[model samples]
Target: MVKYLEAIRKELDYAYQVEMPQMDDWTEIDIQPVIRKLLVRIIGKMIVGNPACRSEEWLHLGEHFTEDFVAASIIMRLLPKWLHPMITNILPQRWRLRKGLQKTRDIVDPAVLRHEEANKKRARGEKVDEEDSMLNWVIDNAGKDQVLKILPEIVLVMFVPAAHTTAMAISNVLFDLCSHPEWAEKLRAEVTDVTNEFGLLGEKLPVRDWTGKLEFLDSFFQESQRMSQPISITPNRYAYEEVIFKDGLRIPKGALVGFVAVHNQIDPEIAPNPEVFDPTRCLRKRQSSPEERDKHLAGQPSKENFAFGYGSQACPGRNYAVAVLKMVLSRMLVDYEFKFKPGDSKPKKYHLMEFIIPDPTATLMMRKRK
Candidate 1:
């Protein structure tokens, strides 16, 4: 999965070279759709492999799956589990999602069969080359019965975590950069200086080599994440057994609990002047002390920084997301200068349940750099 970083870098390069709007006197582009498509293509390639991932129909399905899945999930939670069938039967969005999953099955079924055939050949002492997609990884690692049953859902689920959040994060961070030109200049300089140091400008490098060198860029992303969290709660769980905390607070069996994510992240002790958006806030702490360095990284999750949840179930995809986000930002910094459209301001945020969503309709004025 980590090896896909170079692949993601390639996709980011493609977005810069092809997808981003050509600069001609403050040309405006709605980055939401463009960035979303780029991320979908990248993750689609990572999960489903080539040909299918690049297909226009498949990418379009990937985009709608997120929205439809969320709608169906809400319906499922509201109605009794026994009524799920009837509810899905009635809800148009749920029906669409089911159809999407079916289409996904149609797409991956051949790949799954190929893997099974390979497995049979290997069992007969015949050699077959290893495949790269996550679908193949599941076929090799997960039980055969589970793979057969859950393959379509697995493909759909991969789309859920990677698509919208990544695109929105990219969009919001770009908005933030445009709103704060000083920080944007600093990040551009850092991106330029480091990529030059690594000789990676306009080139794809391995995930490990170049990402670590962009310290300021990392901090800028971390700050953006801190200021604008996607989800409002963290580590939601039901107690299987009665448990007691040190403070004498006890959670009864089957009781639901979740951490107040925003409060923890905004606590003055953990993050000073939390209200102000300082792009270098985390970077300063990272450079301040040895212990704090790892604490502020985008993937590092603690009680205070629970954007990726906590404990064993912490997001496995975050490391990948970190690499991809950095790649996109680095590319944008080098390729374009962006700002709010003429006489337009930053878009206002709105909430859905506990989640905070960025304005997808907003447009940014972009000027290609010489």
Candidate 2:
């Protein structure tokens, strides 16, 4: 996926122009929907490549699948545990999911088949153009024979979560920036310095890692995440049977457990002025222990932060998520300016299930940077 960042970058530019509102003057937008469209297109291009990436039907599935899924999960959870199996079959969520899965197969299955056919041609010693995107990447790694059986499922898995979570992350960060515009200039300056040094602002677009050098931006993003983690508890585990701990702690069978993640973020022992939004926090940590630089990166989970989960089950997509986050944010900071729509400067976050999501209907005023 990292190898394809350049392609992702190009897709983002395309999506930005096509989907984002353009005006010399400030324009208020319900930015979340626009961002969803932009991310879906970019994710589509990365996952399956062109035409499918731009397909309205494919884009609609990418955008809506998770909404239905999350809503369904909430509804099911509200009902009795015994009713879940029955509800799962009859609920509108199940229908939407099945419908989306079919659309996913309809779009991705043929692409996978065509890729396999192209591979057969190459095996016959016939020249064929290389296919780019995660779909091809997965086939190469998973092998053609094994992947064909579940290619659409693989694409669906990648597309839904990637689009929803990343879009939410972007939205939360923008809302943070809007709430605290004092940090905006500092972030913009860092983006400009890094991009200019690497010639990222020009058409040539150097093939090197510029996002790595934006230390302040990285810290700022980490800080934004720290301030507004998606969930209140994490590393959720189920006790299949009764077990006693060495500390005399005991858990009954069928018990679920998780850490209170919000505590760590706000505990003054771990952070000075814990209530403050300090963009320099992670950067200073990274600097203090240069050997452990990656441990403090925006996407990496630590003893202090658990937004990405922990252990082997930690989000395998964290690296890709972090990469896209920085790249897109850098471009946004450099090319445009944004803030809350007047009188909504401090829109409060609302809860959905255990997740703390930004106000879904929030608006932001954005204009091209001069």
Candidate 3:
């Protein structure tokens, strides 16, 4: 996961150079589409490899499979319980998913077969491409015979959670920075100081180790997620056995349960002026005490912040997600200036079921800094 930060940085630089080669002045961009494309490409490269990630078919499948999967899940839930089977078969979204999966298989299966063949040769003391990708890792562990059977599903599973959520997190952080331009300069100052101290910004790969030293950038993302939670609730669980809380609250077996994350995040007791967006909220908290340092990091899912789920079941990719976000945002701040479009103070968020979606229509003005 850490190694991929370099890939992410390279992709970001490549996208900006290739997509906006002629930009000389402030240009307005609906950057959501651009960010989404960058993520698909970066993540595709991480999951597959060089030439495969560049494939239009592979990119399309990675980008849209989640949309199709979500649409299908929603439609499946809307139908009567008994009619689920019948409705699923007839839904266009289901057909779209099937088509997407078939395309995914077409793109992934050949790669898996080749990796399997290479692994066989290596077993007999022959050399092969040694880059450790998700596909290669799976082939090595799950064996050649199981590669085709399991590779597509594994790729889809890894790609699905990352596709929209990470993109939205980056989008919201950009929105917050624009809405509060004060923090933008402050964040840029931090990045500048860190990069100068270590000469990190000029490196070919993201300084994954230095990310921990990026206290302010980490806080900015934490506060961004705090006030603009992508998911309303997390650590959702099913009661497999009758359970009772210390307060005598009893949950029956077979019941679904979860936590309301925003309530704690916005609680005045936990965060004074919770309604206000304070980029330094967590950074300050981390500095306040030794034990409290980890308490407020974005990935730490305490009782107060369930953005990344909780306990042993927390999202495993969260650390990688944060690393990618900081890499992107820090590079963004260092390379360009950004502001919300005139007359647009802040973009309104929409909810789809329990997820808080970023405003897709918002445009941001950007220009290279001289």
Candidate 4:
């Protein structure tokens, strides 16, 4: 994942310019659709490599698979549990999910065979493309017989979560920045200073360390995420072996258990003045205490933060997600000036059961910084 940093960085620098219009004046733009497209392309570059990243079919699949899955989930949640088995057959979203799965094989199967051949070439002491896409890396590391079984799952797992979640997160961050316009200049200054240190004249991708230097930007993003309250519950689990608690409460062997995520994010004890939007809150803690530093990083999972699940089973691709978020925020802050359209402030978010999703119809006006 660490080795893919440059590829992720490099892809965003190109994707943003392509997806975002070069508006010279304030323009009414629906951002979520654009963000959805931008994330798939950038994430695709890391997942499948060059040509596939730009493929129409691959990009279409990457963008919509999650939407169908989410729709199916919401529908199932609305119906009784016993009816789910019956509902799956008639559900349109379920059919789409199956169609997408069928299509996944068609697209990924050929790519796997190609990368497998590349692996054999490298084993024969032959030089191959030095720029190893994640496909190549997965093939190189997996057992020979496991290649077919692994690649498609890897493609779906990697593309769906990373693309969808990061897109929502980046949209929330940008929307927050627009709502509180004062922080833009400050975050932009941090981006400017860091990119200049890396000798990037807006064309080159910065190394991981360069993105790390924008601590102010990091804090702002973390705060925005906290305020967004993206999910209501997470780190969901089923207790396979239940036992008695110290309080004398007992749970049966099988039970669904999970943390109430919103409680953690907004708990006053955990976040001072939790109701207020203070961009520097996390940064101040990071600077004041060594113990808090690493735990508070944007994508890092910790005991209190539930955005990325904590511990060994934490979201494996979080670091890559954070890197892309930083890169896109850095570029957007530097190249564009944005604000909500007149008569519109922060667009209200939608709630579906435990999920708090950014309004898909949210719009903001943005123009080139001149």
Candidate 5:
């Protein structure tokens, strides 16, 4: 994951240095769409073995799949499983999903087949490419014959999570930065200082190198997620035994236990000024011991400051996410100047649907800095 994120950061850096110069001719254009395109492309290349997945087919596949999956998942949850197919089939969503799934299968099938064949050639004393990606790694690790059977499912599982989650997270962070212009200069200062000291941005900076170094940038991302969790609610967990809480509440065995992370994130007791956007909150807490900091941040599972999930189920992809976010934002800050549209006073409101809240559409007019 770290390596893949580094690859993304490198692409972003190239865009900042090489591509931005060409934008001088266009007087006005929406930068967010372009940035989103680049990010999705970089992430697609990382998740799937092919950079071409960012082409129209897979991009359309991503959009359709997200819509259909959300609709299907919600319907299945609200109604009985038996009734779900009937309702879904009646709607246009089912057709969109079928087509999207077919496209996804088409895109991934060839890659999986290629990896399998490569592994076979390697066994027969043929040299294989060293730069082969995650799909190749998974294929090599799993016995070739066994992998050939389960490869498609494995690819699907990896693709959906990475594509949806990474794209949404990037969108949220970009929107937040655009909305809160006050933090821009400070964030830029930090990124500039760090980049000057290290020569390059991205995975080259070790986890320890900037672990807590970019404090304000880290806090800003955390606060953005706190206000707008990627997923509204996490999965439902069935309790095998009774569990007691500090507030004299006992959850009985066989009961469903779930948490509303949003509530915990904004609770007055946890955060002194819950209503205001303050990016400094997490950084201040970081100065203290790990135990104390964890206590302060702990609550019902939420993206509210919990960019990653909680305890045993926390996201393993967090380290990679942080690295990529830092690298991308740092590069953007150093290379461009962003401002809102004229007379567009109010910030764009995040759009919420079921468990997901996507970034609103807004053009961040850009000019290359001297």
Candidate 6:
């Protein structure tokens, strides 16, 4: 996970320093697509193997797969699985949906096949790279059932959790900065201090090292996520046994239960003045000690905040996602000055479709800070 974060940070640094420096010449072009492609490449390299997965074809396939998955999940939720075939087949978007599925299969199948071949070679006493990927790791350790079932699921897991979520979160942060110009100067100062402290400007800094020192940036990200939770209510979970709630609410065995994270995050009792964007809330808590700070932010299963879900089923990828976002944002801040277009004073609001939160539609004007 750390290595993956480092890889993403390295790519982000490269983009900011090398690629973005030249973007001024292409003022007519939109940079969000470029940012999305870079993010997908860095993330893909970590989830799948590097050389095999980093292609224009794979990136396009992944994008299509993401769109199709969102559409399918939405449609399936509204209708029964038994009726989906007929419903999807008749829809105007059905062909694109089918094509998207096929494209995903085509992209993932090769990774699966490669893993199989690698396993065969390993079984025949061949060596495999220790730093390969989750696909290779699963193939080497688990049985054939796991390889067939769990391995394929990993791709889907990463697609929804990492790709879509991270992209949207980064977009939100950018949009927030654009909307709130007052916060931008403070964030830039924080970034400047951290960069100078670590000597990161005009140099490739190790992500792990820099990420640990980004207290304010970390706070900003946590605050942003709290305000704009990617998932509204976590998925419906079946109660293992009968459970009782406050106010005489009882849940029976096999009952489907839902938890609303958005309400908790905005609960004024817990977070006073909850409607305002305050990035310092978490940072103030962190001023004491590392252990206490962690405990404070560990997120209890109360009616407070449960954006990443609650209990044992909470998001396993939260740590990784936070780290990646921090790295990307830090790199961007250190390398570029970003702001909203002129006269667009209001921050754009994000569109929410069921549980998934779409990225805010806003244009940011960025230039390298001299």
On TM-score, the leading prediction is: 4
lDDT of 4 by residue, 1-370 (tens): 7677778677876787788887799998888888888889887888787777778888788889988988899999899999999999999989988888777777776777777677788899998874667777777677557876656677787777788888888899888988899988899888888777666633454466667777998888888889886677887777899889999998778988778877888888889889898999888888887786675788788777887876787789887777777877787888889999888877798888877898788899999999
Which pairs clash in model 1? none
lDDT of 3 at 218: 89
Error of 1 at 313 (Å): 0.9
Better of 2 and 3 by TM-score: 3
Checking candidate 3 for backbone clashes, the offending pairs are: none
Clashes of 4: 0
The sequence of per-residue lDDT tens digits that candidate 3 reaches over residues 1-370 is: 7776666666667655654424669888888877777788878877886667778998788778988887777677767899987887898878987887778788887777677687788999987875557777777777758666766778888899986788889888888888999877788888888878877753633557667668888888988888889878777899999998999999999998988877888899888999999888898888899998776886777877888888998998898888777777787788888897788777888877777887778888888888
Tens-place lDDT per residue, model 6, 195-288, is 7777773255666666656777677776777777777777449999999888889999999777766777788876788889887777776677
Q: Which of 1 and 6 is ahead in lDDT? A: 1
- Residue range 234-308, candidate 1, lDDT tens digits: 778889999999999999999988887878768999888888888888788888888877767778888779888
Of 2 and 5, the candidate ranking higher by lDDT: 2
User: Candidate 2 — which residues are off by over 4 angstroms?
Assistant: 143-149, 201-208, 240-243, 252-254, 289-295
Error of 1 at 43 (Å): 0.6
lDDT of 2 at 163: 76
Which wins on TM-score, candidate 3 or candidate 5? 3
RMSD, every candidate, angstroms:
2.7, 2.4, 2.2, 2.1, 4.2, 3.9
- Candidate 1 Cα misplacement greater than 4 A, ranges: 13-18, 75-86, 113-131, 201-205, 246-248
